[model samples]
Target: MATVAATSYVMYVILRRDLQTKLGWPLGAVCTQAAHAASASMWIFRNDPNTEAYTSNLDSMHKVTLGVDSEEEIKKVADKLTARNVDHKVWIEDGFPVCIALKPYPKEEVKNALKGLKLF
Candidate 1:
């Protein structure tokens, strides 16, 4: 029998819930916001050790998809993450911030700032 070291890294992909609930965006369109942010975050931090580790195991990548009620709420979370020095990307379309994606990191390192969000 063989054992592998435990990996606790994850990428947080947050979507603006209002886009679908209040603004009437299609599910596909809103999900695309999350996809764009996640992709950008991964690409931008491709060389980071945590990202490398997270991607190294393609069969076991971990991601948390969360939702914020409005633009203000989402931006607040982004600001909080920024204050904490967490790396993330705020996806923008037509100059409006649509979603946020954080670079892959140890779950314990980034979960606090995101504790309030609900799964999307």
Candidate 2:
């Protein structure tokens, strides 16, 4: 009998480039937004099996930060993920969408949904 290896899990963070370019937010501010989204997503999905597996091996946990051009782009991605039933959270501040974070999932399962996005 052969055994298959478990798929590695990862969290994906998406931020809007305009947060800095148009809003003139400092780099630290942008980073803070991403952090907030990531944290919220992890907490929201903490009970999920994949989140458990991903966090159990702290050294192996992975996160990828991607960028979008504007708020519209961010909402588009959020809608797409929702349509696909992907677990994620869109962080909003002052009534504006700041960024988004996807809960831990097999990289292959969510990579396609992020196609065309660039690293932040």
Q: What is the TM-score of each predicted model, taking all chains together?
A: 0.92, 0.92
Q: Tens digit of lDDT per residue, candidate 1, span 2-52?
A: 533225688889898899899999999998889999999999999987788
lDDT of 2 by residue, 5-109 (tens): 233787999999999999999999999999999999999999998888788867777888999989899999999999999999999977989899999888899
For model 2, the stretches where C-alpha displacement exceeds 4 angstroms are 1-7
lDDT, candidate 1, equals 0.88
Q: Could you tell me the lDDT of residue 92 within candidate 2? A: 99
CA lDDT, candidate 2, residue 119: 94
Please give the distance, in angstroms, between residue 99's alpha carbon in candidate 1 and its true position after superposition.
Answer: 0.7
> Model 2 lDDT vs. the true structure?
0.89
What does candidate 1 score on TM?
Answer: 0.92
Q: Distance (Å) between predicted and true CA of 43, model 1?
A: 0.5
